[model samples]
Target: MEWEAPALVLSATPYGEGSAIVHVLTGEYGLYHGLARGGSSRRGRPVWQTGNLVRARWSARLSEQLGGMTAETVHASGARLLDHPLPLAMLASLCALADGSLPEREPHPAIFQGLTSLLARISLDPQWAVDAAMPEIVRWELLLLSELGFGLDLGQCALGGGQDDLAWVSPRTGRAVSDARAGEWRARLLPLPAFVLHPEQTGTPGDWYDGLCLSGHFLRRDAFGQRHRPLPEARIRLADRIARLADVVPPDEATGENSPQPD
Candidate 1:
């Protein structure tokens, strides 16, 4: 089997000598791993870096076999964001989440679009990018969960309190829970940020942290847990970054405790 298409470089792990096991995401071809000769060499290193937009071609003798791949850089996102730590970190987290969660060889076009959209936003001026991209990255994860068949129902309270003022999410069911319905069970539920329920509004740093904590819970439980894997380190780091910005302790990846900000 063989194909050539526009691809996003999700990750490139160094293999024997100069070769790399390159993983890429395409709108039509979910996630794909292939062998790229010289991928780690000095001259070839940048092409396979995470978050790059590339024109890639892959070929193999069979549909399931590891293929030989080659790529040409279309946009050097990794290099472009080298001096911008926040955006670079966001890109890394985004790439890592997609790499870890997506099923290979299946198309997830919406997730692909979400990724590219977030990448585009990450290229803006540093502070603007950080502010804007934080919510976007959270939303992107929400999109990923949906694509992975674990979509959160943020429409109305799981307790049937209706959609108004939906303020918490049940970690187990991935459903919204209004403050009134939360009752004594509130502390056990994840926060459902107002901005997440109303995307037109801007999320304060606190809300972004809540959004990450909310989405990360399901991503860990449903997407990675079923496969017996933990959430990606890059994702944890992203949450940590957002927590620091929000003046809050990062949520524990295992416990999903939404730690309150310092008083």
Candidate 2:
């Protein structure tokens, strides 16, 4: 079988001496692993880096086999992000997360679009790259959680039947809670940062940080499992670098009480 599609290079691992096994997120095919004939060489190296956009053709004897890909560069966005450390780390984390979590060869059209959108956004707004990416990444995780059948109810309090003024999410049930309803159980709940519950209301570095904590906690605990697979170091480093630029607390604090205050 043979097919061609728009693909974003998520990862490339050396296969033998000169060849590489390329993992791409395709609009139609989702995450696919294909062998690139000479992907390790200078000419192919640029095209195979994570975040490179390419038009790829794949062929194999059977549809299920590890196919061969002939890729042509459509854009080289990844190389541009290298100059900025924080954006680069964010990019690295994104690639790592997608590579680890996404099901192979299954189409995730929404995620593919979101990834492309993020790449484009980061390329243009280097100063706000991390800030810009946090929400979308959280959204993507929420989508992934939903697709995995562990969707959280973020709209309102799951138990109180009232709007979640200060949502304290239940880690066990993946639901939002109001402060009133969480009276006795307050200590048991995770603070739902306003940026996530209401991004428009919270508009600071801290808000973005809160969104990450909220989403990351659920993703690791519920989606990934308690083995405590830390987020790629690059991600944390990037968030730190960006926080410095914004004159804010560390990335962890950015997600806390001081996220961009609502205008």
Candidate 3:
């Protein structure tokens, strides 16, 4: 079989002396791996880095076999993002998450769009990148959850008729729970930020950490289950950057609760 497609570099690992195994998220082929002949050579090295976009040609006799690929760089996202560690880390974390969890050869159009969108936003400007990217990242997280069959239902609370104040979410069912209905079980509930469910507050970052903690908790528990998998180092780095920013900026404004300052 032979095919050609546009792809985003997910990873590259040395195969032998001069060849490398390249993983790419292709538009038609989905997340697939192929042997990039002479990938470690000077000519191929520039096009094979993670985050570089490429046009790839793959050929293999059998559909199931590890194919051989000839790739040429179409776009290089790494250069623009090189100085911005937060956005770089975000991109790396996203790639790691998608690579580690998603099934190969399975198309995830929404997730793919989300990843590209985030990368573009990251390359824009450092001052406004985090503010612009956080909510979008949350949306991406929610999308991934939905794909894995663990989506959060952000509609009315399951327990209470009062829709005025739906504050927390049930991790078990991935839905909202009103403060009144929460009762004694509130302590166990994940604090789903008001902005997450409210359309009017889409860009607000109220309780962003809580949201991250909540999503990360459920993602690890529901998606990874019983596995000794570690959280991606890129994720750790992003979180640390956010934490550091919080020390200088007011916690509420920085967290996206209040209005964002101009980048």
Candidate 4:
């Protein structure tokens, strides 16, 4: 079987002497792994770097075999962000999360499109850093969890069905909990930021962190937990960086002059 698709480089690891095993996320093919000859060589190195966009063609004798791929670079995102640590880290975290979490060969057009949008935003201004990058990243994480079948119901309170005064999220059911209903159990519930339920609203750094924590809980318990793997270090680093920045940037200003335009 043979197929071709536009793909984003998620990871590439040396396979043997000159070949490498590459994992790419495609609009139609989801996440795929293929062997690439000369992928580790200097001439082919840039084509396989994480976050680069590529036109990939894969061929195999049988339908179920691990195929061989030939790719040509379309956009060199990794190279462009090399000097920008925060955006670069965000890109790396996105790639790693997609590689580790998504199922192979299943189409996820929304997630793929969201990733490209986030990368384009980062590429437009590498210096935007954590302040500019974290909001989109947090939204993307929530989208990913939804695509992976653990979507949080944040529209209204899970128990009361009331939309106003929603305050906490049930870690067990992945649903919103209104403050009135969360009286005693609030201590056990995760904080539900207003922006999460109403994406149109601007959110503070604290809101962003709360959103991440709310999503991280399910990502760990539902996604990675089932796989018995921890969340990637790159993701953890991004979260820590955002948390630290939240301490410095006042809540009101975080979504104002400091934040990047919403993705």
Which candidate should be chosen as best, given lDDT against the real structure?
1
lDDT of 3 by residue, 24-139 (tens): 88756678889998998887788887877788888999999999988988877776788877777777877777776667888888777777666666766654666666666666
Query: Which stretches of model 1 miss by more than 4 angstroms?
Result: 253-263
2 or 4: which has the higher TM-score?
Answer: 4
- What number of clashing residue pairs does each candidate have, in the order they appear? 0, 10, 1, 0
Model 1 C-alpha RMSD vs. true structure (Å) is 3.4
Model 2: residues with Cα > 4 Å off, grouped in runs = 199-202, 226-263
Candidate 1 per-residue lDDT over residues 141-190, each given as its tens digit: 88888888899999988898597878888876778999888998887888
Could you arrange the candidates by TM-score from highest to lowest? 1, 4, 2, 3
- What TM-score does candidate 2 get on C-alpha atoms? 0.84
- Candidate 4, 93-187: lDDT as tens digits: 88988999999999999999999878877876786644456667778888999999888888888888989899997877778888999987877
- Candidate 2 colliding pairs: 203-260, 204-259, 204-260, 205-260, 206-254, 206-259, 207-259, 209-254, 209-255, 210-255
Give residue 129's error in model 2 in angstroms.
Answer: 1.3
* Runs off by more than 4 Å, candidate 3: 161-163, 199-206, 226-228, 247-263
Which parts of model 4 are misplaced by more than 4 Å?
127-129, 248-263
Error of 3 at 85 (Å): 1.2
RMSD of each: 3.4, 5.4, 6.7, 6.6
* lDDT (tens digit, per residue) of candidate 2 on 168-203: 877667689988888877766666766665545535
